[model samples]
Target chain A: MYCRQPLRTIETIDDLHYNLQLAVELEFSTLPTYLQALYSIKEGSNTIAYSVIRSVIMEEMFHLTNAANVLIATGGSPALNSPEFIPIYPTFLPDNEKWFEARLLKLSPQALMLFLAIEMPGDLVPISMITIGKFYENIEKGLKYLDEKMGADLFPCGTLDKQIEHKYYYGGGGIINKVTNLDSALFALNAIIAQGEGAPNKHWDPDKSFPLEDTTGIESGDHQLFMQPRELSHFYRFNELKKGRRYVLGDSHNSGPTGPEININYDDVYNLKPDPQSGDYIHYPELEEMNFNVNVIFSRLLDQLHLAFNGQPKTLETAVCTMFSLKEVIQILMRNPIPDNELGEYAAPTWEYLSPEERTLSSIR
Target chain B: MYRLDDFYDLSATLTDYPVTRLIGTGVGNEYNQTLSQWVRQDVLDELYHCFSQLERNNDGQVCPQALRHQLLSNEKYGPIARNIIKMWYLSIWYKMTDNWSMTYGIPAYSSPVIGVESPTPEDYIISNNAYIQGLVWPLMGSHPMGAKQPGYGTWSDAPLNSIASIHLQ
Candidate 1:
C-alpha cells in the first residue's frame, strides 16, 4: 500500500538538501526504535538481523555525515542538534492534517509497517496524488526552491545533465531518481535500507517472480501482501524466536494487525528467551560507549583535516580525502561487532586504512 | 581602480596570517604544515585567478578600494567571494572548539572556559555552540554572521541546544 505512490519530484539544491537532511534525521531517528526492537528480541536468535540492523545504524551515521558535507560544501551548516532532529514517535506529517502521520517511536506491528512504508520506493507515492501521500509534493517544492537559488551548480560532480538512477528498488520496479547508475543506486540503497533489511539482493521477493502482477484492489492482491501480510512475519518471527521455537521459513506470523510469511528466520535452533519486560531484546550497555567512541573518532578526523590543510595548496583536496576516509570508518563500524570491552577498547582505524593506496593526489600540501 | 596585485596581497595577508596561522598552529604539527602549504599555494592561486579578470591595472596589487569595487560590481563572483571569506572564518571556529569534549575529557556543558559551574541541561547547548563557533569563526576573522545570535532565539536556534534536546529526549 505504501509503495504504490509515484516518486517525489526534486528540482533545486535546497530541496535536495532539505530532503537529504530529513533522510539523515530519519536514519538516526530509526536507531532508537531499532535498538529497542533489537533489544526486545531474544539474544542470539537474530544474530544476522542484529548484525544487519547495526550495519544500517552505522551507515545512517555515514549518510548523516555525507549530508553534512554536502551542506557545508553548499555553504550551510549540517544541523543535527535541532529539536526537529528526533521527533516523538509518530509525529504529524508536515502539512497533512489526517491523511498521514510520520511515526517517530513505538514498537508495534504498525511501527515496522511504517518503516516499510517510509522505505518503499520513492516512485510508489504517486506524484499526482494529494491525500494518500504528500512527501512527493514536499520534494517537488523543495527542488523548485533549490533550482531558483543555486541554478545548475547543484551537483558537485559537475555532471548536472546526466540522468540519475534510483538507489534502491523492488526487483520488479523502476529505480529512484538521481541514482543514475547501478553503483550510485546501490550506494543509495545501501545507505537507506542496507542495514535493517539484510543483504541488498535478498530484499527481492523470490516467490513473486517478475513482470509484477498488478492487483489494484485496496484490501486484496499485491497491496494486501505488501502491507498487512508481510508485516506480520516481522512480529511472528520475533515472537517465535523469543519462545525458543523453530520458526520455519514461509510460516505465517502476525505483526501488529497484519500477518505474513517468515522469509529468513535464521538461528531458530538457538533457545533464547526474551527479557520479560523488554522481550526478545539484545542487551548491550556498551552502546553508549560506542556512541562516545564515534564522537571521538569524528573529533580526531577533524583534527587530522586541520593538520593536513595547514594553509596549503591541497587543503580542499585533503579535506575531501579526509571525508572519504571518515566514510570508510563509518562503513567499517557498521559491519564490525559491538565491542563488549571497556570504553575506548576497540581502536578505530586511521585514514591510512580507509585509503589503502598511498598515492598522493595533490602536491599542494 | 586599484590593480589586481593589491587584492591578491590583501587576500593573501588575510588568509595566510593571524586566524589561518593561529588555527593552523592549534591543529598541531602535521595539520599545520599541510594547511600552510595549502594556503600559500592552492587557495591563493584560485583567488588570484578569479581576481585577475577584475584587475583594473596590469600591476598585480589591487588596493582595498579596488577590492570593494570588484565585490560590488561583479554579480556572479561576489556571493562566492563573500562565502569563501565566511568559510575561512567558520573553519577557524570549527578547528578551535571541535574537540572540547575530547580535549577536557569532560561533558560538553561543564566546560570551565564558558563559566558553567555545574552545567544545567540547558548549559550544555550554549557551551558547545560557543566552543564550536569559537574555533570555526576565527580562521576567517569573522563570526557566524546571522540575524539570530547563538545564545538568543529558541533552543532550536542553536544547533548544540537542538542536539542536546534530541539526545536527552
Candidate 2:
C-alpha cells in the first residue's frame, strides 16, 4: 500500500538549499554505521564481508561528498560541525519510506540485515512510502525546475569552484565530478542514485554475471566474483553477504545468492555495545576518559570536514588523515571489556560531538 | 591481588597520565602480566594492598601525599612504581638495579630480564604494538620509529587531544 511520498515540493531557492542540506545530513549519517561496523570487525576475519563493507564505505564517502558538492553548488553549506549531524542509533535511515531501526552493531546476521534494509532497492522499499531513489528523484526534479525558472542565477559564478574535485578522495568508485552547472548538478544527483539504489528497473548487481548466462539486461564490468570497480549497489552487496553466497549470473533477488560460499564467523568481531552514549561512561571513569578522547577526535573530524566543505577545500586532506587516526582510539574501546557490562559486550565508542567547553579532559572530569 | 583495575589506576597515579589515556593504550593487561612475571608475588600484593589502604584512608581517592609517603616511599614498592611509569611512557621495562634485584627479583633463571622477546634483556621493549602505542610518541607529537606512519604531512593535528591538552585547565 506504500505509494510514493508526494513529490517533495521545492518551490524557492531556500527549499532547494534545505533539501540539499537534508541530503548532506542524510548521506553524512551513514558514515558511523559503516565505521562502527568496519572497526568492530577484527582484522583478517570475514574477508568477503570486509571487502564488500570496505568498498561500500569508500562509495558512501563519495556519496556524502557528492551530496555536499550538490548542496554547495547552489549557494548552500554542509552542516557537519553541528552535533545534530550525527544520528542516534535504532533511528530510521533518514527519509525511509518504511521505518526500520539502524543500529551500530558488530558484523553479524543482525547487522547485515540492517545494512540490507538501509540499502533496500527502490522497488523493494516496503509499506506506504517513496523509495530513497524517489526522494533523490524529487531533488532531481527540484533542481531542473529551479534551473528553468532561474537560469544562470541558480548557480552563481564562483560557487562551482567550491565543488570538491575528484582528486581529493582516493579509491576507485567515488568520482567527485564537480557540480557547477545545471547539467553537472543533475549528473551528480544521478550518480548518487545510480551508485546508491541502482538505475530504475536495472538488475541490482549485474557485473557478477557473464554475458553467456540467462541473466537479463544488466551486463557490465569484468564479470568476476569480486568486482574491482564496485558494481554491486549497496543493497545487492549486503544481500550477497546475507545469503552467504555470491550473485552468479542467473540468480534473481528472490532466488537469493547461490554461487560461492562466503565464510563469516559471527564470533570473530569485537562486540562493541550498540548505541553507546558518552554519559553512560561517567561512573566508569576509565571508559569515560576513553570516550572523551573518542568524542574529541570525532569532533575534530567534523570540524575539519566543515572547514573542508565550507571554503578550505585543501583541509579535506587533513580531515581524511584525522579520520584514520580515529582507529587507534576506537580500537582501544572496541577491544576493551567493560566492567560488569550488559549482554557480555565489549566497549563501544559514543562518537559524540564535543562542545567547545567540553573539548578538554579537564572540563569532562 | 593482581587486579587489572588496581594496576591501571596505580599506573595512572604514578605516571601522571589520566586513567583513560593509560587504558587507551590498550596494553594494560599485558603490562599487568609483565608485573606479575617480574615482581615478587608478595611484594606486588603489598603494593596493591598499600594502594587500597591509601584510597580507603583518603575517602576512596588516592591522596597524592599518601601515594608519595606510603607505597612509593617503601623500598619494595618505590622502584616498582617508578618502573611502571617508565613502562607507560616508554614501553620499556628498565632493569631493576643490581642492589635492588639481589634483594627482590623474582626467582627465575633468566638473570637480566624476564621477558623472552628481547635480544639484550637488561631492558626490553614489550611488544612492537606496545612500542608503537607508547605515550612518548604522542607526548613528543610524533609517532614511534619504524611505524613512520600515517601522520606525515601537516602532522601534529592528531594529538590535539593528547595528555598535554587534557591537563591544560
Best by TM-score: 2
Runs with alpha carbons beyond 4 Å of true place in candidate 1: A1-16, A93-108, A122-365, B1-169
Residue A12 displacement (Å), model 2: 4.6
lDDT of candidate 2 over A1-365, digit per residue (tens)? 11123446888888888777777776766777877888887755787778778777777777788889888888888878877777777666565544677677878788888887677667665435666677787888889899999998888777666678777766435467888788888777777776676544444554334222432212232333223233656777787788887766666556676677778888889878878877777778888777788889999999999988998887888887777678777877777777788678778887778787789789877
DockQ of model 1, rounded to 2 decimals: 0.01
Docking class of 1: incorrect
**TM-score, chain B, each candidate:** 0.30, 0.77
* Each candidate's clash count: 80, 2
Report the number of backbone clashes for model 2: 2
Best by lDDT: 2
Best by DockQ: 2
Tens-place lDDT per residue, model 1, A1-365, is: 01122335566555565655554454455444554444333324555445434433434444433333333333333444323444444443222323355542223354455545443432334534332123423543454466466654443453322221222112121123343222333344343332223213423443332221232111121222223222222222234323434333333222221222223343232111211111111243333233333334444444443332122313333343434334433322232233343331212211111121212322111
Assess the local accuracy of residue B169 in candidate 2 as a C-alpha lDDT between 0 and 100.
Answer: 50
lDDT of each: 0.35, 0.73
**lDDT value, residue A130 of candidate 1:** 38
lDDT: worst 10-residue window of model 1 chain A: A272-281
In model 2, which runs have C-alpha deviations exceeding 4 angstroms?
A: A1-12, A42-51, A126-128, A198-231, A245-262, A289-293, A325-327, A334-338, A354-365, B39-43, B50-79, B93-123, B145-152, B156-169
